[model samples]
Target: MGYEGEEIEGYYCLLIAILGNFDASEARFLYEYGPDHPVCQKILKKRPPPVNLAKMSKEEINQCMYRLFEEGYSKRSIADLFSCYPSTVNRRLTIGKKQDAEKKMEERRNQNNAQTDRCPEELCRGKP
Candidate 1:
């Protein structure tokens, strides 16, 4: 049967999902056996892995994740790309949100403190 555009896209998505679940040796085995193999067919038919965030050490990954999040990618999508568990993505996003909130609060506090440190005369003069 000839595949349509959607079908081809779906097949690639399945392949990507399966690839994420496989280690290097398994991937090599699949590559050696070729796509026409029964195992390969079965893997392709199987459901893709759940969305999970990958553990990232590099600042680049962090920046990419932030950008993806800002661009409105679902957590599952990010997890799928990173080959990590969905919970990992959620945890990281949560931590980031908390840190951002804390930073903003600190900035506001500092601004308020600076304003308070200025004398009333300075406030009237708009010099502080």
Candidate 2:
């Protein structure tokens, strides 16, 4: 069946999710839009529960947090996904980003140290 009306409702869902002080959970949608809402209907259609973040590795959590942040999920929502405090999300993200930055810097330093692998003769000739 065509879901033109439901498709339009997606925007309302997005607005509610973004503007509401709510977590990215089924309860949030059910509470705001009611259980009959298309969004909630889709959610309820799935019997399986979402994966618990506790079973995931720290790296996985970090990557998930980063991906959600890039896709515009609020920090609070991300924390809710993991059932953690927002401060925990912020702290973990900060540390993860710092490590990524350091890794990039280290890579750059290694590239610089390579110096195009030139010998003294090549350096004197100014070929690189």
Candidate 3:
């Protein structure tokens, strides 16, 4: 992986600078940095802690849920798309379904009220 330094076509390569020989999906590190590169070497020796979505804010969780639902994605697909745990996808789906149901109910109520109000004026007229 590269993390920082010289631009490769105007795009800074950070992974190439910071990370070396580490592939998460493949679960392996294939590069060996020089002894002078201490930061990359240390990162290799001690793996960094994984991000915990359970600690994320409600807004963040909602955003994930909406993306998954609106895009018609499966839990596993969403997990891979967002680089999160599959369990997180399952949890978000449940919450998203409830929220969607509530929204539909609210919309139905508003529509019904609008129709009733429109009918009242016509019903009041005797020369219909």
Best by lDDT: 2
Evaluate candidate 1 by giving its C-alpha RMSD to the native, one decimal.
11.7
- Give the better candidate number (1 or 2) by lDDT: 2
Task: Please give the TM-score that candidate 2 achieves against the real structure.
Answer: 0.48
Q: State TM-scores per candidate.
A: 0.46, 0.48, 0.44
Instruction: State the weakest 10-residue window (summed lDDT) of model 2.
Output: 42-51
Candidate 1 per-residue lDDT, tens place, 34-127, comes to 6689987664444243433355554445555555676676687677767778888777776666666677899999999999988999899989
Which candidate should be chosen as best, given TM-score against the real structure? 2
Full-model lDDT for every candidate? 0.64, 0.70, 0.56
Per-candidate count of clashing residue pairs (backbone under 3 Å):
4, 0, 14
So what's the TM-score on candidate 3? Answer: 0.44
lDDT of 3 by residue, 1-128 (tens): 25333234123233533353234321222223333466555544443334357687875666556755575555654565557798877777778777777889999999888767675668678333
Please, what are the lDDT tens digits per residue for candidate 2 over residues 1-128?
Answer: 46986666666666665654333565456656786888877655542225567688887677667666666667876776678899998988887777677878999999888886769798899877
Off by over 4 Å in 3: 1-70, 119-128
